[model samples]
Target chain A: MITFDKTTKTYDGGVTAVKGVDFTVEKGEIVVLLGPSGCGKTTLLRMVNRLESISDGKIMIDGEDSMSLDSIELRRKIGYVIQSNGLFPNMTIEENVMIVPDLLGWSKKDKKERFKKLMNMISMDSEKFGKRYPHELSGGQQQRIGVIRALAADPPVMLMDEPFGALDPIIREKIQDEFLQIQKEVKKTILFVSHDIDEAIRMADKIVLLRGGELMQYDTPSEMLVRPKSEFVREFFGKDRAIKSLSLHTIRELQDIIGLAEFDEGITDTITINVNHDLRNTLSMLLNQEADQVIVVDDEGNKLGAITIDIVQKYLHFEIKAKPTLVEKG
Target chain B: MDKWLKFLEINAPRIFDLTIEHAILVGAAILVALLIGVPLGIYLTTNDYLAETVLQIASVMLTIPSIALFGVMIPIFSIVNLGIGFVPAFVALVLYAQLPIIRNTYTAIRNVDPEMRDAAIGLGMKPIQRLFRVEIPNAFPVIMAGIRTAVVINIGIGVIAAYIGAGGLGVLITQGITRGDNYLIITGSVAVAILAMIADGFLMWIQKRYTPKSIAN
Candidate 1:
């Protein structure tokens, strides 16, 4: 666990890069630091590794002060990956991955073993890639090396700074999915930084939205998107806010909310979709199941109201004046 | 034989030996300089507070006139009598040679991408390990080029120590002038130039060998 307690950094002449940041990266969770350019998300992430020292307050890893450890040792203990996948141009892939273990004075056998494990984890064939210099690999391949190099030591803490920002969309999505799977297996505490809100929504267990180095919002991506604390966040999440909301809920979640569909009483009546799912996906589910109407259920899986095309349209266009209704709670 | 003929005849073998002697001195100096200078160069690159200071000091030491500089070290150690004659000259050459190799090593390592530095650090390299494993190895080509330049220059200068009984081809040149023997001068001067060319070729070979083959394209 890591916590920033009123951590602030003010440069000379008082340009505060970060101002009183207070957040915690929970264990085994991907906490994304997200914001627009110059929002200081990158600075906040760098502070964790002490790449930039804080001006005031404290950052604690577990219960220990982050400043207490030697900077080099502290950096070595946490994995860091950056946007460009900054590989040492002079080194081969295997040498790049083994950089840390070599630094730690691991024996030749240990270095080789770690390299093999990391390459396997990143899906790079050690035999093909191990001897190839960084220049030899393509863009996506190099990024994998960047990621696995950080993971070589298998540290519990990982810091990534816009790791997916440079790749093409297809490659970007693949790496993101791969990272998600890797995170599940390794379960390291991760602080991922990006300006892409959709990525934050997809990746972060906790999303931290920063503006001018000030903490604007820190919450789950779903909450942050639906209930932005400021106009800045709403604008930053931008025009596709509704689509991003849907991404979190999923087609399965909205299966019950498909606009208006006429229902028929088939003796006992019929419905599709489980009672427990997000209301945002209600429309798509109705269209796919080819059902005229689906029964919306309450907490105990009891039928509350049936959703047809018209009803779901009402739910879509109409803001629930009472409260944000959970479809499962309908 | 006539006066000039006898002079050349008597000193021909001596001239050949002097060339070999000066070649060995410069070669030994570069080796010893590289041993001390490379690590210092690494340190200078990673550590900024002293980099400019150390670099300037080395540059200043190298720029002073060689005869005047060697004259200064002669009294400091009382090494004139202790079989330290050639060794002390070797030491001066090493010190003089350091400015180029050390500066280039520092430049090469410092010029390495900061992203690469961050990546190495991110990947768990402690500073010392990164210096030897990544930084030093990456900087070698440029550093070797600097060393090559220094070697040729040092070999050219190394013969000058003969002015003070540090026997080499310079002894023949200085002696020939004092005794009115042009043959000695020609013989002595040829030895120095040939040694410089050969030393330069060797340095070029070393530089080429270490230069990454992949850079050719």
Candidate 2:
């Protein structure tokens, strides 16, 4: 857990980059700092790691004042990933991932086991890639090593500055999904910085919106999308916020609220989707005319029922208008 | 051709001794240059103003003709009572080698990817640890290139040191010139050429051996 109590940053030239911000990031939550360029979102994220020094106020990490700890020791305890991936070209993939452990003087056997486990997390073959330098791998693979290198020490807090921003769209989406799965198991407190609203919506447990170094709104993706606090927030999310919020709702939620459409047997063309798939994607499948029938299935592959475009729209209207208060979806 | 071959055959032992002398002079100068220049170059990286000034001075030193610099060294070292021998010649060669070694080290370390440096610092590496493990290894190839250049150029310049009574292969060239012996002069020139090539090849092998395999190509 981390708390920013009236945090601020003023540069040497007296230009303020971040100002008087306060928030608490709960344990195991992924809080994304979202804003336009130069909005100080990155500065705010960096302050938690003490990368950018706070000029005023205090930052508390796990109930201790961040300034009170030695800066080197403080950074070691926090995992950091950047946009460029930042893997050392001189070191092999295993060496890059095991740098922190090496610094801490871990035994060779322990380092090797951690290396293997980290490799498995990203589903990359450890034996094949361990001895290879970073350049030998593809861009996506290098970034995976970058992410795991940060996780090597198993730090309780992670700071990511657009960790996947360098990859192509397809690979970016794949890695984001991969990282989210990793987060499910590790459950580190993460403060992420990103410019893409869709990425924040997809990954953030809570989004802290900023504008010109000031806090605009800090809320869940769904709440921010459904009820924007300011005109800037509305404009930032754009007019399709109702559709955007659909991504946060899953097929299971929709089915539980209004129930799925009855499975029709006569339709020759049909496709099956998992019950946990997001409503926005399900809506896309329905609108794409890929099939005459779409069936929702439970984890056991038990066929539940059919879902159509009408049901998604019904839910969208119900979620936006009929719902009285924000209920956390996950 | 027969006369030149006979001169080479008769002078072979002397030529061998002079070549060894030449090699030691160049090698010693470059070793000292590296010890001084490399750390100085690294230090310059922290101060932009100092870097520019120091690099400019080294460049000016390089532009001075080798023999003229050797002559200048004679007067300066005379005050220390070490003029016109190995000391002045060694001093001159060391100065000449400085530009390449210092410039290359500075450029290589300065050009290390900022992201890599950030990662090193963020991962809790001390400044010294980052220098050796991250910055120096990344800068290895270019730094070796600089050393190779300095050694090769110094080999040629060391021949000129013979003018100051620093015995080397250049002694043969000067002797042949005074006595009007083309064969002896050609022998000296060829030996110096062969020595330069051998030194360069050795340094290249060292570079390939130590360079991080990932960036070898």
Candidate 3:
């Protein structure tokens, strides 16, 4: 667990990156520090491992004040995945991942075992990626190495600063999903930083919305989505929150009143979409089916609702003025 | 071929003697530059207040005429009783060599991605460890290039060292010049050229050997 009590950091040039912040991360909690750019989300994350010293306040990790611990020892216990991967240029992929363990003087046998286990966790097989150098890897592959390298030593704490930022969209999503799966198993207390709301929404077990280095709200992803605590958080969801409400709604809530016979089965298997599925996915389904109405269902196969052209229009929201707002006070 | 053998037979002893003397001076100068200048350059790189100021000093050093520098040193050494020969010539050549090493070391270390620096720190490396293990390895190519430039230029300057009685092939050339002997001038010129070629090749080999695995396949 990590705790920050009234932490403040003002750069020498008098730029206040963080101003008197208070927060805590419980053990094994995957906390995403979310914000728009220049929000100091990264600075807060760095404070956990003391990469950036807290100038004014105290940071305690695992019941020890961060100031009391030897910085090298403290950092070795934390997994840090910096934005843009940051693989050392002088090392091969295996060596880059092996840095911490090599520093700790882990025996060659244990190192080899951990190397295979970590690469496997991140879906990078040792045979294919181990011998390659950092420059030899594509962007996504480098990000994968960055993620796994941090976890290589199996530290109890993990900090990822937009680790997948340089990756393409498809690869980013794949890595995100892969990282989440790895997280579930490794169960390290994670602090992930991201400027993108959707990533924070998707990845965070608990979202800590930060603006100007101050905590706006820290809550569950579902809670943050359904009830954003501030206008900033609401705006970041980008008009998708209300539309996402359809996903949350029981299919019965949006289903048209009709006899069971009225429904058609022509596109049931290939064309119709589920209520939980996105408007973009559903639109693709409609286009493919060339049908007017699409059947929607729950995660189970039970009937939920029907999505028509009107619902698609509402989801797309060409009518700009009709939008939801989240109020913030204090 | 016979011309080479005759030149070798006539000057071989002198070449060997002068080479030992030249090697000591140039080698000392380069060592001093690497010792005092390279680290100084790295230090300046990390300090915003002094970086540009120190670079300006190094650049200005390049502008100082090598002959005039040796000439200036004569008076200073005369007072100190360090005398003219090897000391003055060594001092001049060392001054000339410092710039390339300093500039290249500074640029290479400075240009390394800050993200990598942060990552090293994030992974628990102290600043000193980061410098030696991460920054130095990353910046070596540039630093090696500086050394190559220094070595080549100093070889050319080694000829001038004979004016102060710090004999090398330069001694042969200077003696050939004053005596109006074409054979002596030609022999010293060819010898210096050969020395430069050999040194260039040697450093190139080192550069290839130490190139980081991460930067290459």
Candidate 4:
């Protein structure tokens, strides 16, 4: 676990970037630091790896003070991914992924195995891409390599500073989904920094909202959506609170309302929503199909239950209470 | 044409000897310049004030006329008991080659993307590792280009080395002028021009070969 105790950062000219901020990131959780520019979200993420020095307060990693360790050694122990992908253009893809491992003096056999495994994890053809330079790959492909390079050494804590910020919208969404899948298998403690609210809500196990270098709210996505502590947060989350909140929930959360479905004796519609689909997508499908109720199916096309507009509305209005399952396991 | 042929015949053996001397003088000067200038250029990148001061001195050195610079070197070498010979000319040529080599090295190192440097540090590379593994490879092509320019310029300045009794193609030109022979001057000037072109071509090939393929474009 990484703990920040009253951490503060003041620039050379007395500009305070992070003002005695405190938080704890538990293992196997993805915590996002969400804020506008200059709110110190980046600064906070960087401080964990000693990229940015804390002017005051202590940062502890697993009970050991981070400042007490060698800065280079500390950084290597934590994975770091930046927006620009940061792949050395002079190195091949395989060599890039092996940077950290090679730095720690991994045996040649060990490095080769790790390289192949990481390439496979990203679904990249190791043989074809191994010798290719970083510039040879597309932007999204390069970023994927960037992520696995961090994970290659299997660092417990991963720090990502807007890793997908540079990609176009379509590519960004695709990469995020792929990353979410990877995160499920790896289960490393992650400290993610992003300015996009949708991205924060989509990926974060917990979101730490910041404004003007101050912690506005630190809560789960559902909690932030349902109970925004301040008006500034509500505005920051934008006016789409209800729609955004729907993304945090999957159809399985409304299992209690499954029995409310009235099976009409001779009616069959080919359209079916998957049980794994988020509520936002299910709702959109409901409206687009002009159906009052839709059958929810499992991966094998087994009809599990049906979701109706009334049920969705009831959940949205808080008429029904369900425990928020923040992460969906595949 | 006959005059030219007669000149080559009478002076062919002497011309051959002078050509070897010219090559040695310019080649040695450039070798020394590179040994000093490239590292100095790299050092300058880390120290802004030092970079500015050193670059200014090099630029000033460049502005001084080559012949006058040769004259200045003569007195300095004579003070050291070297007198007027290859040493003075070689020293002068090396000084003249510094501006291109140093400027190019400094500029090339500076041109490395800051993001790449950040990535290097973030990945836990030592400062020295980052310089050799990251900075040097990226800065190489530009640095080589600088050396190319310096060598070509040095070949030309080497002809002036003959005035101080440092023999080269310049011997023919100096002797031709003293004897008022246009044929001898033309032959000498042509040989030097061809030599410069050949040296430039050779360095260009080396530059292309050493450039990292990823950043070749």
Show the lowest summed lDDT stretch of 10 residues, model 3 chain A: A253-262
Against the reference, the lDDT scores of all candidates come to: 0.79, 0.92, 0.79, 0.87
**Native-structure RMSD, model 1:** 7.4
* TM-score (0 to 1) of chain B for each candidate: 0.86, 0.97, 0.93, 0.95
Judging by DockQ, tell me the better candidate of 1 and 2: 2
lDDT, candidate 1, equals 0.79
- Clash list (residue pairs), candidate 2: none
True contacts preserved, each candidate?
0.52, 0.76, 0.94, 0.70
- What is candidate 3's lDDT per residue for B1-217, written digit by digit as tens? 8986887898788887876676677778787778877888789787877888877887898898777777788899889787688788888888889889888998999998998998999999878888988999999888999999998888888788787777777887888899998888887888788888888899989997998965633
Identify the superior model by lDDT, candidate 3 or candidate 4: 4
- DockQ class, candidate 4: medium
Candidate 2 regions exceeding 4 Å error are A323-330
Model 1 DockQ (Cα-based): 0.34
- Candidate 1 per-residue lDDT, tens place, A197-298, comes to 768888889999998999999999877766777778778877566546655763233444443233445625467554455455565676676655576655
lDDT for position B65 in model 1: 94
> Per-residue lDDT for A192-214 in model 4, tens only?
99999989999999999999889
Number of the predicted model whose DockQ against the real structure is largest: 2
**Per-prediction DockQ scores?**
0.34, 0.82, 0.67, 0.78
TM-score for candidate 1? 0.78
The 10-residue segment with the lowest total lDDT in model 4 chain B: B1-10
Where in model 1 is the C-alpha error above 4 Å? Answer: A68-73, A103-114, A259-330, B1-12, B46-50, B60-92, B172-190, B208-217
Q: Per-residue alpha-carbon lDDT of model 3 for A236-255, expressed as tens digits?
A: 66666645433333334334
